[model samples]
Target: MVCLRCVMVVKEELNKLGYHYISVVLGEAEVIEDISAGQHEQLRTALLKSGLELMDDKKSILIQKIKNVIIELVHHSEDPLTVNFSEYLSQQLHYDYTYLANLFSEVQGTTIEKFLIAHKIERVKELLVYNELNLTEIAYRMHYSSVAHLSAQFKKVTGLTPSHFKQLKDKRRSMLDEM
Candidate 1:
């Protein structure tokens, strides 16, 4: 689950099932009651019907958590991190950055850096489409060193310059989940 609507769907399904939840954050939830095996299956089925999955595997859950953290950082957070991403993820997830990076690469078949870059680029596309901030402000918000760096990364990823992309009518940005 990467969006608020996804959280609402989960909360709705849980409420219908008569389960009380403390909170339903991006990738995980905390329920007030202990869930039985039957209840687990039922919840999984309900979430599946609404296009969500109940992840069981520890590694998969960790990967999902990583994705969710990145999504939150890029899409939700107004301020960019003061520390580097490696340190930030390590602090947030309570695991070594190397281990997380390796597991992410093994399971997702891509480096964490690539995944982050893709999401960051998507966020840039979004900012451009909004037309609220200029390129320099965008660079600062997205944590790029300079406008040239942002433009180069944007062009490399999207095959178009930022100005050109903004000018085009079809301004497409990927969903958080898709990234």
Candidate 2:
């Protein structure tokens, strides 16, 4: 689960399955009662039908958590993180940064830094599409050191300059889940 709609779908599925959920947050849902195998399977299938997966393994769960953290920070948060990303991630997930990085790379076939860059570029695209913030504001909001840095990274990732992307007739932005 990476968005509010995904959380809604998960909650709806749990409710349909007659489970009392304690909470349903991004990438995780907690039910009050212990689920039997049959119940779990039913819930899993329901989630699949809604285009969501129920991760049972610890590693997969951890990966999802990492993704949720990134998605929440990039797409949802208004304030920038005061600490460096490595320290923040390690503090948030209760694991060493190296372990999290290795596990993420091993399972996802991509480094955490690359994943973060992809998402940041995607966010930049979104802001450009919205036309709400100027390039400098976007750079600051995204925690980039300067507009030149943001523009360079954006050009590298999208193969188009920010102004070019904005001026095009068909502006394209990727879905959050797709990223």
Task: Point to the candidate with the largest lDDT.
Answer: 1
- Each candidate structure's count of clashing pairs: 0, 0
lDDT of 1 by residue, 1-179 (tens): 99999999999999999999999999898999999999999999999999999999999999999999999998888887889999999999999999999999999999999999999999999998888999999999998989999999999999999999987734344443356
Q: Which parts of model 2 are misplaced by more than 4 Å?
A: 169-179
Give the TM-scores of the predictions, in the order they appear: 0.92, 0.91
Q: Candidate 2: deviation at residue 101, Å?
A: 0.6
Candidate 1: minimum summed lDDT over ten consecutive residues — where?
169-178
* RMSD values, in order shown: 5.6, 5.3
- Model 2: how far residue 126 lies from native, Å: 1.1
Which candidate ranks first by TM-score, i.e. highest?
Answer: 1
In terms of lDDT, the poorest run of 10 residues in model 2 is 169-178
lDDT of 2 by residue, 30-105 (tens): 8999999998899889989999998989999999999998888888887878999999899999999999999999
Q: Give the Cα error of residue 2 in candidate 1, in Å.
A: 0.7
Runs with alpha carbons beyond 4 Å of true place in candidate 1: 170-179
